[model samples]
Target chain A: MKQNIYDNPTFFNEYKKLRESGITYNDFIEQPAVKSAISCLEGKTVLDLGCGTGEFVRYCLENKASYVLGVDISKKMIEQAKIKTENGKADFICAPIEDINITDQKFDVIISSLAIHYIEDYDGLINKVRNLLNYDGVFIFSTEHPIVTARKEMDNWIKDGEGNKLYWALDDYHEEGKREQHWYIEGVIKYHRTISTLVNTLITNGFKIEEIQEPQSTSEGLNKMPKLVNEKRRPSFIVIKAQKSCVT
Target chain B: MKQNIYDNPTFFNEYKKLRESGITYNDFIEQPAVKSAISCLEGKTVLDLGCGTGEFVRYCLENKASYVLGVDISKKMIEQAKIKTENGKADFICAPIEDINITDQKFDVIISSLAIHYIEDYDGLINKVRNLLNYDGVFIFSTEHPIVTARKEMDNWIKDGEGNKLYWALDDYHEEGKREQHWYIEGVIKYHRTISTLVNTLITNGFKIEEIQEPQSTSEGLNKMPKLVNEKRRPSFIVIKAQKSCVT
Candidate 1:
């Protein structure tokens, strides 16, 4: 049977709680890099897939976007997005991004954060994204870095009682496919895609990559969040911005 | 101008010296794994490419093979191969594997060791190997690990004054291409290919892979060569055995 991490109630609730408490790791480390990669959102119709609590939709609205649409597979995530977003300012769809009907919609921008890794077929989804975007539209996203996702266990670091790290180890990096995590839930599947596979798939689908960054904490940002300093040892996530090709 | 590492007299001499020292890294760790991956070599016609010093060709001869052909680009390596072999037992060809004509030859086994990565066109070479082999013939080879070749410096580990290790770092692994190193000679170029690209290319070229090994020294073996224990930290080489298609 097909399953996703966001579908698990315990995992989703815990994830939503952390995001609501403003203690999310992606918010501190990855979001800023992803946000800066987006060139312009003003007066553009934006579509955010896997939009938890409509965060990107709201950000687009705040930046004076003309229209916004958010899609998520989780029912509660859409509920949260609907409650936080103003009426008529944004629209929410509670369906997997794969099943969503984008035939009548054309977007000026498409963005997803910490998503797409759950989806198995990259080539098909990329083709869909290419058709849904305007010729000039930019697609930007962040996902778990292949290095991090390759590990079956994310707890490779040796930590002391006070939570100080003593060492970190990397293994099985060349192997790719479904990886399972059991930290806060059981058998949560996350797809491990290599850098070559990920970037090559995008280029194959007629997108020209503009910028790619493996986000590291700036000195000031690190000073504020000292725990994030460990992220510099290895990239925690990958952010890429690609512009749609004018020709198929 | 066209070039291969075997073309440089200085580099080739050092490589020859190291291999003859009976203390080579590949001999200690990778060779055994690559050799054992083949099921049977007895009474088989064997073609060994990049067959420096005719080690594998000699191995085939020792195993009571009916015929063996060793091909290499280096004159000195071919000379060494001739010196070590008896008349009518094995023949040595002093030509690049890419330029050599194998159309007149059909072999039960094709083997290469710590080679093929130097040649840029893996797909072309793989196709050639397929054509040169009889149906059910197994092709066994090994190449430098992607992780080791990705580094620009080649020396990712820093050692203390006493030669104790202080740090081991990994970077630039996602990128693939030529990496220049100044080891025993000036401006030595080594071609880098990722695991995905290497294995995928072989598969695409119509070879059915049987077994793949990333050799690390076993504990008892490591104890015999304590320095080889470091090789266990990460695979230094990848060994693959693939059989020719039985059907046209």
Candidate 2:
């Protein structure tokens, strides 16, 4: 049997319902990752791949972009996105990432948020995301830092000399399209990638890295004092903003 | 007790040791923050207040800066900083933060690192740093995000959804300029300022806010899976790169 995202789709449905009912969970696009992505997006015709809930799409719309297409696989997410963006600032589409065919129309900015990790076909997803971009158009998205994934054993955390604790878990994990089956809290399917593999796949698929941001904690990390734990040890998430290279 | 900072000063000595040993701690400046700051430092005389080891001073020198001066309260740190750049790319001063009066030579860029928290007289420190800047010059620095201090509790930690497994614990007390506060650990001193406080301090001191970046994690945050308990919860740290307004 295909794994249930939760024992029932009702959970995600409920989650989406909750979000739609004036309750917003995490809008990954509103986070700093997407903010960094906006630098390359101004004045570009953008395609938001896996544009769940349309937060980023709206950002693109508000930033005076030529136009924006918010695409997602979840119909409910699309409906909620359409409802939330009642101003009709941008367009929304309900389609799997694999089915996003932008052969005719190209975009100057293409992006995704925390949504791409759910897709198992890594290269396919990247190539599809790449195909939607115009020359030098950039792709920016964020994911769980690979180090956190590599050192994911719950016991990897330890205290430092200052008696302040730290998690030195996986520093980076990347292998070409390696698959790890995940059973979400409700038994939903999830997939993960490492930094190297993800970047390599993008390079192979014709994208050049313009910038990558490793976000520390919000107001929280500083108080937590992760800086002294290990100097090079950063947080567990990275926001990557890459350009579709004309050279490539 | 005049606060013997240079006399048998342990934190100063530690900073000197770290610098003299040619150690590169992540504390002084972040790479992206450095790049962003340097972008604004071109052809300018840069002053690094609280210049821990003077790494950013060196960066300014290597970049398009006309001149660079690094000031620190620690004698040993200044000594090491001088030794590190004997080629005279920059100059260093070993003086207390408040005592360094520079009315003659104005700087185009003034910066600080994770060092300003050691200052108890936040207003005085801000004034001194501000006074050092030339008209329309900038004062850019990175500090511990204030939200980290105000919102987080010592018991707030990362855990699995079940809350049974402890992922990480936060236990650090830095009472901003009070040496040897009784935390669970021993540390020098630190002050906590929220984002608004930081902005207000800069504005009140005749500076203006240019940009603020709450860093995400490294490549790890983006590529990996098995998110940290705090990944979605808090920012790790904040990088505030501000400027001295020409009008003000």
Candidate 3:
């Protein structure tokens, strides 16, 4: 099931399998991404676009947020949320990110994590997130580093023993929205947007690049051995925290 | 650094790198496991214990859950969640799973997706989950598949070719609370529980095993590839949904 994760139960199921086996999402989501998003959340009303399972929603509530709204397209996920939460504290809605209606209520903060990559249209998604926020509201999000999407050939995307980390050539990455379909899943879609494309889209959507967070890898314990073997390596993830232009 | 996710800028920064670079939590938490978890969540009060980033919380919420409580140890994660959701609609708490004062609340559904592996004591973890649920409350969760964990030889983990796709050798399928430090992030802890450990834990905790979903690769739409190309592969993940015993 190589199809895009949304359409393919098999592909998504495989991922679920991996999680159950042993790996914890915290190991991957880590601290840097969560912390950066929290820094911008202080005393602000927030709209968590693509709020999968309300992780960030819970985060904001405990941090003294005045208001919050979490929305997602997955109805099954929302049902789970309803049972686990008290409605007086946090609200969750089921709606596609693309078709969300941003009514009169305005939010000071809007954040998404690793969820935007699944969207087929980049510009439309950014514009939608922009519409949901109040004037000068901050929008901070973290996306799958473009490098992985730009280059799908697994072999071309690994570290070698040449005393340095390796990356795939540019050609493998330039292909846009490669089609990976499966019987058990619908078409798997990924739009590989470079940092430049990402920046330009925000600007087009009236967002100013207030901050750019590039979380690099650290060599403390187990990583020291790998780093000692190959010191020159680039990190795999990036966190971008931007603000809705107060200028307008 | 562990006190709050926001305090640790590295968590966000490094996580961004991994996401951008193409390493995803999806790789570990697959779709099949999620669907299996969803199957059990119909009209149930779910507690997503150790719910990081609340993906499963959203899943339960969307599935028409009667109620949900998204809990995690990371205060910063809880704060981001507050920022993302409406207050009092769904609830979120910042507390360790062990310290959770869950006496009055008995969930119909208690779930921990890719979270429990962090608890080093498997028996204690299961007993704790059992204590939190009501009679017939389904405790459904997923973890990294045992085959994948047994294949921690590193080099042999990522194999390709052969009739079996992504074949992981089935070796030690029952190890309880095997502890290990995370590879990418420092100061994080993880535990590996085998099938026997998981099943026995459920039985010992007075929960009847309801379903064990084993997913195999299917070439539903391979252009010219034979369906036999993927078969009898070692499980990369496991989704176990068990119900609390009403009798006894």
Name the top lDDT candidate.
1
**Candidate 1 per-residue C-alpha lDDT over A1-248 given as tens digits, one digit per residue, 9 for 90 to 100:** 34656657898888878777754567677888888888888899999988988988999999989999999988888998999999886999988887777779899999989888887777787888888999879899888877577555656554579986544444555456788877578777788876656776776687765666777766666766787777754567888777786655
The residue pairs that clash in candidate 1, if any, are none
TM-score of each: 0.57, 0.47, 0.43
Best by TM-score: 1
DockQ per candidate? 0.04, 0.03, 0.01
lDDT string, candidate 3, A145-226, tens digits: 5544544432233446874333322223324565343323444555566544666577657775544543433334224333
Candidate 2: which stretches are off by over 4 Å? Answer: A1-17, A20-69, A75-91, A97-248, B1-19, B22-44, B52-66, B75-113, B119-167, B170-187, B192-248
lDDT of 1 by residue, B1-248 (tens): 43566757888788878877766677777888887787877899999989988888888888899999999888888888999998796899998887778677799999989877678777878889988999888899998877677656677555679987544445455456787877787676777775556655666666655566767765556655787777644567878777775543
A-chain TM-score of every model? 0.92, 0.74, 0.76
Tens digits of per-residue lDDT for model 2, B25-141:
243224455466446556789888777566777877777688888888766667767877756558888777667888888888777776665566777878877778778777777
lDDT of 2: 0.59
Candidate 1: residue A238 lDDT (0-100): 83
